[model samples]
Target: MSIPATESDTATRALEVLRRLTARDDATFHEGQLEAISALVDEHRRALVVQRTGWGKSAVYFIATSLLRAQGAGPTLLVSPLIALMRDQVAAAERAGVRAVAINSANAHEWDDVRARLAADDVDVLLVSPERLTNPRFREEQLPELRQRTGLLVVDEAHCISDWGHDFRPDYRRLADLVDSMPEGVPVLATTATANARVVTDVAEQLGGDVLTLRGSLARTSLRLGCLTLPTSRERLGWLLDHLTDLPGSGIIYTLTVSAAEDTARLLAEAGHAVSAYTGRTDPDERVRLEEALKTNELKALVATSALGMGFDKPDLGFVVHLGAPSSPVAYYQQVGRAGRATESADVLLLPGHEDADIWHYFATASMPSPSKAAAVLGALGTEPLSTTALETRVDIRRTPLELLLKVLDVDGSVRRVQGGWVATGQPWEYDEERYERIAAAREAEQEAMLAYERGGTCRMELLQRQLDDPTAEPCGRCDVCAGPWYPTEARADSVAAATGALDRVGVPVEPRAQWPQGADRLGVDVRGKIPPGERPETGRVVARLTDLGWGGPLRELFAPGVPDGPVSDELLTASARSLRDWPWAERPVGVVVMPSVSRPQLVTSLAEGIARLGRLPLLGRLDLADGAPDQTSGGNSAYRLAGVWGRFAVGPELAASVAETTGPLLLVDDLVDSRWTLTVAARELRLAGADAVLPFALAAVG
Candidate 1:
């Protein structure tokens, strides 16, 4: 393909300009970074660069704007989230002898000059925040001139637009609409350091342009991840002193609260280390001074809140230590990502006290609403838009419940914000028609992760890697399981044996596939006449039977080839009746025996009846079925059954103990295979307590 004029000459000129600019001692671009800049400028379509901090991301924009201006492409607009970062970039541009300016939240009249320059095609680039673009005056006045001559709309921190992003801002959603409304086919150049696959997709879709992803490997091989379980703040500070004392390079110590930051700094200084503190409460001028001081290695270590990391590109930061647990893994990752920017090995220490877990638990539980409250919020907002403040005032609920209700409403599309207020745009009664179904699905996935973290008896790193969809993961030999036994070795061995034994005892026998009728010719009356009685006819039964046999269950023992000679005992009959009733077979009748070749409806009805009976209050306590797949054992299966029993009898650990005494093989069916609760309870009681084989019923029978 022949290269476009904008692609060839513009990129070549941009590289030349960058080389000239970086020749001055004040400006510097790292090796090979100029090529990255060239590719970004050369691309006729929109592009993205996922470069680490201190890799000259700002230099790419500065050089590209100069090239675009020289190519007569009009002006460029840089939309960033932080105002301080905008000012820093404009100053940096001036130092490089480039005529550049910014119109941010602090300077309203500066935009008029920017607009005039754009009309005359005078300015190279104008940096503004997303919030400023929402202003009616700017949109109506300045945006028109810039749109007609705009070269590129650069979206810094592009991850904010994604729902799965760590910092999701509602205002970022309006960016796509703004870009589409722009004239002259204004292509976008988005940049971020930590976007995963989903974040990359969101940025591409939102920008409405072809994507050029420059994602480097996420493996920070140099940084060693470590966790410290401390009991008190005194001990934590002592540990910090031991690590940071006489450290040659600068480092960051992060705290959650402003007071904690100040206190930690004070303690470190008293310990004879040159230290400083930065928080939101710090004066802007002082904060800037502290950042500069750290960059120059004047301060040995900086004890600060999370505010210090964003937009502060310090490549040589030797270590980043968190005084307490962060709100989420994203926050932790971002903080840790600050160190080891130059591919130099760094250290990250996480000191999580007991209170840290409690704080996290509070946040998680407080963020979700009860089912009834969610329904109530939807009902109150019926077909109307209301602001969040208005809903809080109108809805009779507490803070936690109110936040959860809004989240549910937002997910269900029963409510949405138009402008600054919420609107009820969804069918309140239709659960399946939710617009935020994707959001809900993401939350459910996170919930599964949290549940696993709290209950799974495995390495923590393995769980995190699996949740984040990271492939090619090893055992992470540093976690609790890899370093030391999470459970006693003997206990684990016994538990595995018991779990295997339970399955062995409960599995039933089934007839061989070769002995059964096959193909259309096998469906005749005589062929049907040869079929066995008391087995439900279901489409999925064959699959379930196969699974049971593989798990060493009683599939063969329960369905031996020979017919019974006498009437079956009530105990055996009850077991069969319960199995037929509770199992999710494709077709079966309730309380009615079915020959293997019975009509589908008859089989369906029986199975349905059995399911219904087992689901009823009294009998429901006796059995628990997993959701989705009937053959698997899940935590929810046991939890739901235990919950049912608890609801009926107010039973707790005592009842659980009594149930453990049963010698007969217990057959449990779960809907899903990866339920942590089912695994926890079953492993604890059956394997640890020496129960008979615990068979997992694979088929979902009705009746």
Candidate 2:
């Protein structure tokens, strides 16, 4: 049995823990922090702390951990959200004289050693990502013993646990189960700088039993928030070029998309700013280096997507500027909270884009799974293991939503993963239509609220606080609404031109699919492993990615659902011609052929004909699709995609004769290239027909 600490004993020990953590004699808790710490240390009660950034929430946990361990309790277990957060927490814990270890994707090689340390009681805190909780090996081999010894379980960025939260994560929902399983009277804490009243209530209920909820004024005194709506991407990039250096200390420039982040960073660098881009595509090792660079002020700014959003700690960050609006005010608050953490006066500016809603819609739909798709996935899975790509071939679901559904199913006990791939446990799974509907409705409301935030006349900071249900919400007198406009609306003409040029620049590499996807032979093509170099198309070129900052806008408009397919526009034709001329190749194509487009035939035909006419090459005749052939490029797994388009395309008699006659490489043009299976199968047909080589080209490609 554990004895409670006296108030005086808890106070003195808390001060000691703070001093060890900050190495400052004057360190002390702000407002309710001490009470939260005391509740854990003295009363052994669960608590949830909702406070603003820079309010020292991490201090509460570190101090509480130190005191708990001093009383002979076991190590703290932290379920953090990102690699960056884990790194910071481990370092913070060590600095405070608490030995710490983290087991995540980046440090897999150290897992055995770390597990030994934990079992031997050599570690004081262990930080793991939320995803690790669902791993079969970890769950069966390590978790049970780990849980028995865990002194206090901490869930950082607690809002993620709530389905209503702006950044809802399916894995975080597993915490509710963990909380219920913990030994009675062992304390737990959930901390987040974000979270509205609803999110707080939701997370608190998930925490189980009676939880002491301490909510604080969600105000960051250092932030001077404001919004500036831009009419175009060019103006937004130009503004950054003109005004980036004027901002105070090192900070982050947040963008709604990965391409925008990269484009902004590149333009800023060309104009002599020290900046780097951080996105989901960045390598894990590189992300660590970039975070350190920002913390050390080595880079003036890191242009980033929300990959850097939750649990990133950089006190004294000077500013945070958004290139476009996030879909929710709650998310916006969490991001802007990264700034003005330890200093007085940090500028927070939102440059909302006209195209933001379309991006929002695209991302939102990618997560919410349709019922039919979910059923197909379940029907396809059995005791046999199948990879994500395999499931795609069988189910109509795309990669993103399929993976999200898998996670949802795994947490719900409907499916379990094995070493080979994923296997269904033969458990019944319900669609949870009512819950999904509520979640969908909540998302739409958040989007509208975010839009209102940009259009609202009230104090920007106060508006945000009110959205989070902060009763103490009041005008901070620091934003544009409270004070006069502090930023310029106009950018220099030359800078605007530069920005436009950057956005206008087109052409991205289309690397050939080197190896045939696993299990493709069963699709009836008989091709396996590496394609013979002679049969494969050379590395190709696309006018641009549909997701590119330069071409994404026009391409999105062209491909948006229900848009009638038509001939390529004059400007796009000119751009396509330029792409052909700019493409660097070992040898120029001697002729051209068009791939049949089930969805955009006119666009494909007109563009191919126009190009062949200009280049003075024969339009060798089109690859004809057999009637009823499935549209391969739409979406599907590799094998089925191959199966759909495999025997679907054949060289027409004239095209076969022309290919046999051509002694040189031929170019294949299409409206778009997504999976590349359409091109691959078509090229294979041409190769068998005696074309010397095939060089594939598309107006746009999906990354």
Candidate 3:
């Protein structure tokens, strides 16, 4: 039984914690920081802080946690969005004399210890990702107790809670349910630097009706913004190479795609820049290393995708250059906000590419949950739990989208993931048709705004601030529009040539699938487990991926929807022959076999014929489609895709005879490889027909 902390006591303690956190006795609250902490600790209310970056949003939560714990309350529970942010917050919490610990994917081994400490009441703050809330074991075992015992709940990057936000996530929506279930007197706080009026209102309503919202101007005075319209990928790369060092201090070079990031990083490295690519595909351990390298100024800059967004803190970061524009102004502002946080001045440049709209469309469609697909998933499920692979065999949705749909369904209480897998909850779930349509329309408008930002005539900073509905948006007298372009308008001729040559280089490895997708037997496909090496296709080569920076542009044009099917172009044929010439194969191919392509038959045939002619190999007959076989549509999990094409192709008498005559390996060519199942089935057919080996070649591979 302890006494409640008074207002004066809370204020003194909060100030002490703030000073400790920042390691400066002279440091004071940044306008609303102290008020936010007092509202949580003293008033015990839900609050949302919408301030610009570097305004000490973390200080509010850290100091409030201190005061709450001092009042004999339970430890604060923080739901952070990213691992990098959690790491930084934990370190900051420790500096304030708060015992902080995080349980994320990177530290599963220490969870037991964390739980033990929680039981002993030794931890003052426990941070976890929003995904953790849906985990069956944690939801059942830890969350119930934690909710009742939590002193305060903090949702960092709270914009993710609203679908209208630029970076909405399904898991973040769980906060409403968590808040509803928490015991009375457990204060809640949500913080974000980038949120428009609509997102702010939506988040406030979700948190509760009686929530205190603190809004501020989104302008960054220390940043000088500018946009450059580059017509080609080569020119953008050349500009970066020519001016990367001259920009300012070490910073980030943001790319819209993983391949672009890797490509840019490679070219920069060749030019003696200490940079590395950071993307979703990067390993967890390596991500940590890269984050530290950037923080410590060990690397000049990181070539990154949006995966590097949110929770990365480098106060002295001198510049941020976007190789491609993001789809929305909110996202662009959030990313560029990373620069000039703790510096006097920093350069923020945008090199808008011609291909930006195409990439934008891909991401825009991918994130939206389809109603038909969700219904198909729900209809396929029963009372009993089923694994993702088993569900995939019954549904037509692709793996990534299916997984996202499941998360959405789970958040809506329509499904629940249990010990073994996921099960239907029998809860009614309605597709909010009007709301989804509105959100889609809003996204399109945002895209238009981004385009407007590129065609700049207004103050860049003012445009970004207004995009976030900042009431204080005004000209900063720093952007290119206000001061004229501060960056070079052109690249050196030699740099452009180097970039052009780099993009012109082709050849991407198309690795053969090893094990078959699980649960294929349920779909009437008998294959499972590892593919026999004797029947496997040798490692293959593709002219390029549809997502590559160089040749990808032409490949994307060739595969664009509504484009009429035709024979391969002469330039592509020459490039394909060059790929064959550069191949480091173990043994020369004796012949070339074309895979049946219903969509692009002429293109596939021409490509195979051209390769055979160039290599001086015999042109084997094309494999025939089995009777009653249908053309398989793209998009689905491995198992579903495999089942669709399992027995679709067969080696006809002519191709079989040709295979038998060829004692050495044969080359199998296709136009595009998406799931890689057609190539697998075709290679197996050729191998069964007594061909010594099969080598797969494709014009383009889907990313």
Model 2 is weakest, by summed lDDT over 10 consecutive residues, at 1-10
Candidate 3 error regions (>4 Å): 1-7
**Alpha-carbon runs more than 4 Å astray in model 1:** 1-12, 20-43, 95-97, 106-122, 221-225, 269-273, 327-329, 342-345, 361-703
Top candidate (TM-score): 3
Over 1-703, each residue of candidate 1 has an lDDT whose tens digit, in order, gives: 2223265665456556656666653343454345555555555556777654556677777787776566567667888876557766777676545667788766676767876775666667778887666554676676776677677778887777776665665456567776787664455777776565677787888777566665543445445565655545555666665657533377888886565676668666866788988887788778778888988889987888767755676667887878776655544656777787765566666665434453454444444345665666676675455655455444445444565456455544456545655666665544443534565566455544444443436655554444433453356665444565221112133433433332232223222111222221222212222323212222112212312212212223333336332323333334444444544543332121111111123332333344445544111122222222222222122223222222121213443454455554333333222222222233223333333333333332110
User: What are the lDDT scores of the predictions, listed in order?
Assistant: 0.53, 0.86, 0.90
Listed in order, each prediction's TM-score against the native is 0.54, 0.96, 0.98
- Candidate 2 per-residue lDDT, tens place, 420-524, comes to 679998998888889888988888998998988898588888988998999999998888989968888788888889999989887777777778867666556
- CA shift at 612, candidate 3, in angstroms? 1.5
Give me the runs in candidate 2 sitting further than 4 Å from their true place.
1-7, 383-393, 418-420, 522-525
Q: Could you tell me the lDDT of residue 76 within candidate 3?
A: 94
Looking at model 3, the pairs that clash are none
C-alpha lDDT of residue 595 in model 2: 87
Error in Å for residue 211 of model 1: 2.6
- Provide the clashing-pair count of each candidate structure: 53, 2, 0
CA shift at 246, candidate 3, in angstroms? Answer: 0.4
